[model samples]
Target chain A: MTLHNKVRQARTQLGLTQSELGVKVSVTRQTVAFIEKGEFAPSVALALRLAKALNTPINELFWLEETAQ
Target chain B: MKQFFSIKSPLWQILAATLLYVVVLLITYDKQHSTAEGFTPARIGMFVAAALAILYSIIYTMAITRYNKRNPHDKLSITGVKPAEIRDEDEGMRMITARATERVYRYHSFALPLSMVFIALSDASAYGVSTILFILTLGHYLTFWRGVWPAFRETSEE
Candidate 1:
């Protein structure tokens, strides 16, 4: 499957609601939801914040089908 | 019907409502205790609810400020992606922001009605029904607004 950002997955794993996640990352929960749905992309800082909040690396936070090198 | 729901009106509505709520509390307080007996749970709750609203307002204002400091036309992410990659994700983001806000308003609207039902159940001898409604309204709306933040980044033009 095409790998999307692990925000929704990692969020569930971390047991944080979007609001909680938002607070941790200094964003509104709406931002979290949009990122989770792939409807919006986080800024570099936000992406980094989210990754740190979720305790994952940015590479893991967002990844795609490994381009067949 | 659409003409009825103007943005300008909500500010007025919120202000009028808070005033009416204040009058109700004051009148009830005057009727009861009538003396300088102070610090009722109802009053405390009213202050707390007001405080909560103020807190949310502060946070929102600060966030808006922080947001504005950023480049409005900046690319999708802070990540070091090339320009070509940035455009697509940025477009997707704007779309999410636009749609998410509508959802926030819609969901919060549904919860507002529950306040009436709760208010009806409130006994006069019991805690203030209005206080309960106020706190719940603030809390739920906050939750809803927070819940929908992700989508708010979605631009309208999709």
Candidate 2:
């Protein structure tokens, strides 16, 4: 299973820089970059915080995709 | 000057000091075993290197504390004695640190017994044993630094 996110799209639409979004969610800008790149998966708490910061629902922001073996 | 107090500074300091100390130890090893004198010039050089390492550690701790005071939003730790990369201000950095330390732990898990076997087979002296331990310590930090440096660069590039 792979977790995918629309964090970059949402964040860009909101005119927020990664650093500004990080400040809102109490994470580092690198973390925001990772989340957008699908390299790092956030915890549920952080997901909710990101959802709140981006003004998007958690489900819309992130979803899990199943990959074949 | 600001770069001197950056999060990666301690690793650089540790690498330099460890290399200097180990080189001095290797050079002085045979002399110490062969000579009856307690304080050879090489031995004095080793002591001076050690003293400098200790002094640098104290200054690094103070710099961390001052950095925390200046940037409250990015405070590293309450005590300021911990390395900044390990006790970073956010979860991403902490996760990176965790991964780096995990690699170090795995490296030591294999390296420790191998080192012990080599030491026993070689009939290493007390000085040789200590020197080997110092090299292992340096390896630990190098592994961690290798793990985290790229992430630090990626983050700072913005």
What TM-score would every model get versus the actual structure?
0.33, 0.80
How far residue A20's Cα lies from its native spot in candidate 1, in Å, is 0.1
Query: Mind giving the per-residue lDDT tens digits that candidate 1 earns over B1-158?
Result: 33122221123234434655665675566567555568766566667666666765565445434543663543222223331111122333445434544655675676667666656665434236767655655554344335434333332211
Report the interface RMSD that candidate 2 achieves against the true structure, in angstroms.
2.3
Leading candidate by DockQ: 2
Off by over 4 Å in 1: A1-3, A66-69, B1-158
Query: In candidate 2, which residue pairs clash?
Result: none
For candidate 1 chain B, the 10 contiguous residues with the lowest summed lDDT are B3-12
* DockQ, candidate no. 2: 0.50
- Residue B154, candidate 1: C-alpha displacement in angstroms: 12
Docking tier of model 2: it is medium
Residue-level lDDT of model 2, residues A1-69, one tens digit each, is 889999999999999999899989988788888788886789899999999999999999999899889
lDDT per residue as tens, model 2, B18-127: 75666567456746654746776667666777777677667766876787788888776546466565735567777777788898899999999999999999999767
TM-score of chain A of 2: 0.96
